[model samples]
Target: MWLLLLLPCVRADSRCKSDLISSINITAKLQSDILLPCNFELTLFKSDMTADIASVWRESPCKSELVLSLNVTTALQSDVLLPCNFSPGLIGLNTTADIAAVWSHRNMTVNNLVEITLQGQTMYWKNYNRQIKTFSSVSASGNFSILLRNVTQSDEGLYQCDLFNGTGCRIAYQEMHLRFDDSPADGFLTWLVTAGALGGGVVLLVFLITIYICAKRSTNSSNESVSRELYPPEVPHDAVEYTLENPIYDAAVQSETHSSFRAEKGNSAETAVYTAVKKVKRKERKPEEVQ
Candidate 1:
């Protein structure tokens, strides 16, 4: 009864008298405020035929599963998203030109959710100060999902996402339900996620450092082995100690006394005999030598 009050009768404008309903039927999650897609048509109402547009939330016949599978629990005043994808595959939608989208809650025209041209531009219709929007991802990818921000009790209801062609023909339908309730925040889950992320990051860093150090050490050892193989180690040269005991040292010292015997490296070898004698004056030795 309340929905019928919102059904709009099209104006005499020849351009506006097209049937908004489509053959495509939509399915949604149970026991929640659902968005029910009405083909290319949206739930709309007009107080007078000349009004700019009628409200949508109070009018859409989009029904979630009457059977309660499970309730989506969210805190009041918290933002929630009710997913509704209006894929044309549901009813084999084809368009010669670009397609547009219109979203409605209950039976009203959601100007904020209206997209006149497919993938062209979006016009936002404001209800309250609240931010309700369709995802841009849906615009590009054909997934028509809307976002409800700062939800209130009044916002809990059915929703509809409809697709339209360039000719203003509605093509696809989808619906979903979102319910916000009062619930305490799960502090343990938040803390656990934070700690887990930190721990994982620390472990990853440590593992990388260990791997780098081991690789460096292995590379250094490999280089050293290669160097040793390429150039063999040389044995140290032997050194000799002399207290005038070695013949080479004694011969070198005595060679200075003999002028005719030059110690040239190219000269013929000559033997030398070493004997120690007491120092005597040459003149005194000369008398003994004459005798």
Candidate 2:
């Protein structure tokens, strides 16, 4: 009898275990429709889950606190979506709550843009109206994301989303920036400075190359001129060392001519050539022999 009772209790315990999720995994895009996967749920994800999700899980006196995750960037006059979704155990179980997304310019507290609310309404604080809307079925899907249509320069500031439930209230803050393009002159000035720097570099390089070539050519010409000056002009090598050797043949010829002239009779009346014999000093070829 006790065994039969324990079997029923075990079956009931197994059913309850199957209903509760063991682990949840999800992946999503920013500022877009959040997908609820029936296959997997999203549980407390952070490693220190107790610190962040204690408010979502604790009983009766529960509290909610939000963290600002991402900053949004957009251009003026464009329709863009800002992302703000809070995940808690209550949003998944109840499928609704007092969820609100408010956009506020810094220093303008009274003029808040209560653009999107989970109660399926859009309201403004300063009596201003624009096409700002949030998804109606987002609560059912546990997403409280909003969309702003035709944004303006004045729309640039901080945005907040406050969540309220039986737990407590949590506030999330995100910054929105309106981007502007640089002025025409600013762009032109940057281009002008860059072009001038590049052009100056090119000109300086060309000038340096020209100077190098000219200097090399000048050095070569100077070397050639120096060589020319070293070897002086117009003095012949043969003229510097040549000697006049008379060979004494002229004296021998005059002596022989006088002998012949003496043989002739009428040569006495003309310039007479006399055969006078004298010893000629014979110099040795390399002069020291004679010395």
Candidate 3:
């Protein structure tokens, strides 16, 4: 008898577990746009049911813990789209179904951002009207994706989207974690690249300057060596040392000096011969007196 009772419970537990369809994680950059996707089929809910009993789970009441987990990372000042779409699988295209979606931030205050109803295609903004936006064809396309513009630091936390029937029973649930990107690592990488480029440029400049200086010094040294080899300095010679060392020059000067001395001696000899003749006449007069 206990086993018979447990069989239904086991089947119901398995059915509830099957409702959990998808879990997604996304990473996005700062100031960029991102989308968090959540999609499910709505075949169990009948379209012929009245708006008050639109949820099939109301009759068979499953556990409320079937939640879709989504983790999303983004930076400040970003635009994010939290998606929640349902397909009317078995429900006829001509028939209409009533569904409501509520988006809320699960922080210190469970702040409701917006509520969208598919019946009259009505949208009610609870808190952030200016920052939150949605597609006009949300009811037609069954897309309850909410666009959050210019997300701030206060937006960092868990966000939830709850789909309810007209009876106010939540049939589907999704929660997402929004966080700031690790921007410091990107900044450090950018700084590293910039510093590396600057250092390389400085090193190249220093190398070029060194080469220029070395080339200039080498040119000056080469010019100096070539000038010394080509135009050697002249050394002056002493005249007396040159004349004494040369035999031909000494002999020519001695011959010219001896000729000049002989000419002067010949003139003196002519004058002395005339004076000796007068002295001879006086000696002859002295001999006549003696005779």
TM-score for every candidate vs. truth? 0.33, 0.36, 0.41
Across 64-141, the per-residue lDDT of candidate 3 in tens digits comes to: 343578788876787987776655631125325666678889989888888776653545655587898877475555
- Residue-by-residue lDDT tens digits, candidate 1, 1-291: 765654543234543666555566667778868776554323444445324443453343232222112234566677777565544543234433466656666634433355534453666666532476655644554665556788778666666666655454555555655566545465666777999999999999999999999999999999999998876454221221224335555444555443233433333224432321211233348778988
Model 3 C-alpha lDDT versus the unseen true structure:
0.67
lDDT score at residue 263, model 3, on the 0-100 scale: 49
Please give the TM-score that candidate 1 achieves against the real structure.
Answer: 0.33
Off by over 4 Å in 2: 1-64, 90-92, 96-103, 108-110, 115-119, 126-129, 166-168, 171-291
Sorted by lDDT, highest first, which candidate order results?
3, 2, 1
lDDT of 1 at 79: 76
**lDDT (Cα, tens digit) per residue for candidate 2, span 80-168:** 77666655654545435565555555546635566555555666666445566667566445455667788767666666655544333
Residue 108, model 1: lDDT of 47
Taken over the whole model, the C-alpha lDDT of each candidate is: 0.54, 0.56, 0.67
| lDDT minimum window of 10 residues, candidate 3 | 235-244
List CA RMSD, all candidates: 21.1, 20.7, 21.3
